[model samples]
Target: MNQTIALIGNPNCGKTTLFNSLTGTYQKVGNWTGVTTEKKIGQYRKDKKIEIIDLPGIYSLSATSLDQKSALEFLTKTPPSVIINLLDGTNLERNLSLTIELCALNIPMIIAVNFSDKLEERGVKIDLNGISKIFGVQAVCISAIKTKNLDELIDLAKTTTQKPFKISLTAEKGENSAVKRFSFIERNLDKIIIKKGTTAQNKTQIADNLLMHKTLGLPIFFVIMTLVYFISIKLGGVFGGVIKNLFDDAGERLSIYLSEKEVYPFIQSLVCDAIIGALGGILSFLPQILILFAFMACIEESGYASRIAFLFDRFFRAFGLGGKSLLPMIVSSGCTATGIMSTRIIEGEKERKMTIFLSPFIPCGAKTAVFSFFATSIFGGNALIASSMYFLGVLCVGIFGRILKNLKVFKNNKDEFLLEIPDLHLPNLNDVYMVIKEKIKEFITRAGLIVFCVSVFLWLLKSVGLSGYVADRVEDSFLYVLGEVLKYAFYPLGFCNWQTAIAVISGSFAKEAVVESLCLLTNDVGALFSSSYSAYAFMAFILLSPPCVASLATAKTELVSNKWFFGMLAFQTLTAYTVAFIINMIGNIFVWCGGLLLSLIIVIIIAISLIVAVKILSKSKCCACTNACGERKCKNKEKHSTI
Candidate 1:
């Protein structure tokens, strides 16, 4: 008979490392009860008869967060035959609180007291047998990371018999045996364990003192982020270059073959310029986008992000935002859809709302290609000017969040937070590869399907001109009319032609389409539109525009509200137009009328920003604070009292 063994533990308990060891790459998936969080299952390497379920990393069974609720549901509802409860040996007091609850189920369970090495070096000891006796279950000592005594743990798990069900001793029962279990273990500790050098602990303690210092932590976080962005951008460029070359070669071949075949003008335009132009243009940059995601995944897997969250939590709260929002914002700097999906982890209502409202300010992955191509090709890579746009993204979100909080959109919410700071560790390459593969797959799936259809539709729009193909002349196409209408709006940017506006419109599908469309329009696809000021202005516009239609659709799906979806688009467009106008004006400093208009626009946008900030911080009455930080998933309602 096969045994279904569930590995359960608190977050940062090395639970993932343990699962990686037991499963050895055989993990299968399902999502737990109510949410989209994944459920992992795998056949044991040593015993195919034994199956393992790696539950979410949760601290308790109180059903606090959606993640916690899923774990509790799996434990109470599924009733695995054997539970491998991996408890952090150093934090036994807090960790054992949950073990006491699990013990109530009375199913066979083997406690794997991990991190025993760290405990022994701390001059602390644990009596494993004594804990087993009090809990009426088997307990094994194993270091999952080092594979110490792991075979014995696997053997013991195989033999442990199911104990009859029993309730944990409660305070009402007068014994409170959870504490008794700790006392029993402590009394026998000296005989069972030993201590050695305390160097690692001392070093970590000293580092923590400085790292967690209130005055210095925030500044240190900023310094680290500056370094991460620097490395990510530099590395991404190398990878993007290789991918773009392959795409460029393929595109050249296709265009040359079509020209040789003597295809008609409108048909050629529809096939090459519209359809292939849009999708192929952005698909070429998948390498850079994947590289950026891989870099973030490595950091997250190594646990640097948790410390980052701790360092920034209080700062975000001052703007009525959450520290958890940092991860989404950072991810959004690569892609907004990924950023929006990441919001699911934020527990507080105010925090989640604020993150959703502000995530668009980050320059997504697609837009960065525009920055790279334009910055180097046109301006010879002016680092200071290029970097200013990144800071502008941050400035927008911070100021926007503060301003919105005082409005009807966020009247009754004052954000507050608590976070668990996991220790830094080496990132697993397997995990890194897995993340990169998933992101690349998502990008391809979208580019091939949605983007392909949009490209074909755009081709149809550009094909119906009045003269050569469909009507009297080449200038009367369906797309020409729309482009002509938009020409005046972009007059200040110095590229006031219909082709530039049409490129911006098609760019809603994929950002690189702007450059590609311009290339197609002028029949010189490489380094053709080399106006540096105009290039800078156009890149800025694409960066700040509403995220592609795919991302907006994803936002609607995730938020489950059209209200949030439309609101994001409206805010994004407003910010994009305003930012673009400012950049265009500044770029045209030598042009008299453009420079004057740009100065006036800057003054107006800044004054509006100040008024918005004043309005968001205005106070409001609320009775929601008591349990606001205490719940998650947001499906349950809490009883409230008047403040």
Candidate 2:
């Protein structure tokens, strides 16, 4: 029978890189019972008897946060046969503390010294035998990022059986023991390992110094993000072109065939309009999303992400949110569902909840469709507005945090924000390919499984008459009833109609459904609804609204409370309505904002809040929040427990 082995390591220690190399895509991603952090299981191809569990990156087994607790539960409750401990060669002293902590579990273990190339470049060395002796475990010199001796390392892991290694737990006593460990690891490093650091090492160091600069770093970081946005836009445009052509061709051919068959126009229009035209039109963009993820996979694989977190932590901490928020926020840029799921990495309850509530602010891949459609039509593809929407999302998150800081529900909470900064290395092609493949698989599965059923159901709602299976326009469809009732309240926002309202209501299931439904509504409401600027404004309203169904479900799972989930939903809805109302009113002014203007009051209220935050609490509150980035000040952050 096959036994299990696990590779446990601190964040940024090249753990995922190593796991990907070891198991490739022979991995399973699922959920742990009662928690939101995803579980991963894979088997090493080299040894059928050896299975690999790639747990979340955690600093220590005992830490109370989600990932750390997961590690401890796995190790203590059901210890693996062997633990492959990955130690950062450059940050050995800190990484070794985790090693020391793991040793106490008496679990059979081996240490893999990673980033050796970085160590040698920094004039640092490590004695492998010395480390092995000190930790009482087999230590192998390997570089997961560089793929040096990787196969041999796996071969060594295969030889090890399920047996615990016994070691006494004692922090070597001294006022400067941690410092001493750092010094000792540095001075004696050469005895165990030799490194011929190349130019990559120098580049990482240089990048790190500049990226962490107090001021210029942020501007540079934004520029880099702008590049990512630019790429996403270009890739989306290209992919969208292909999808549009295919959709038109398919729609036309299908229409002609139905007519030749003398099929009823009602049946023909229902099949063509509701099924193929709407759903197919939206799904055509999946290629673009998958391609974007492919590029991101490479960047994340190389470990440059740690430096980004570290750099942003300086400013992020001052806002009462963990710097770890950056990753989830980036994920939100792709899709709010993915972003909400990524919140598993955040340890603090307040922080995690905050991230979840705020994540939807960043426009997701689904919203990209709406943005490209309107921004170009309205402002000649004004990149600034598109970019401004993203920043506006972040700003909204920060401002929301500021308002909630003094609330009774979130009082006196100290956030321990600390993380690992791994040495930078170029992402290997193999690893990048693995992540992209898995992400594509995930996207396909979601579309094929969850969204597929929903889309079909949505098509039915759009085809069948609302009053009970009668034939008529989409207004006669079932969604129209629900949308009409809600539409009455939205009249002031200028989109008080079922077709427009239905798309926004349906978006909560998954935001892409918004655009998908809109595609369905187009022919019916084209001239009356879509021709005006309110069309773009209404799109913006739904785009910034509450997260999708999957995200809300995830938030419920993560925060363990529906109260907060709905609370977030309510706020998101209110904000969407208010925002849409103001924007519509503003545009109408450029066109015709006479005196039917409750819109002006809404803008004034928002402006007043922004002024209050900037004038009163912006600077001080930001500085008080603990930073969980990779830095000296954030080094000792263990985990802040969430209620």
lDDT of 2 by residue, 51-99 (tens): 8887766766655666677678888898777888988786665687677
Q: Write the per-residue lDDT of candidate 1 for residues 516-552, one digit (tens) a residue.
A: 5565555542243335566666666777787777677
Q: What is the lDDT of candidate 2?
A: 0.67
Residue 531 deviation, candidate 1, in Å? 8.9
- The runs of at least 3 residues in candidate 2 whose Cα sits more than 4 Å from the true structure, single-residue gaps closed, are 26-39, 61-66, 116-127, 161-201, 264-267, 302-304, 317-319, 376-388, 449-452, 466-482, 524-533, 584-643
TM-scores for all predictions: 0.76, 0.82
Q: How good is model 1 by TM-score?
A: 0.76
Which candidate number would show the highest TM-score if scored against the true structure? 2
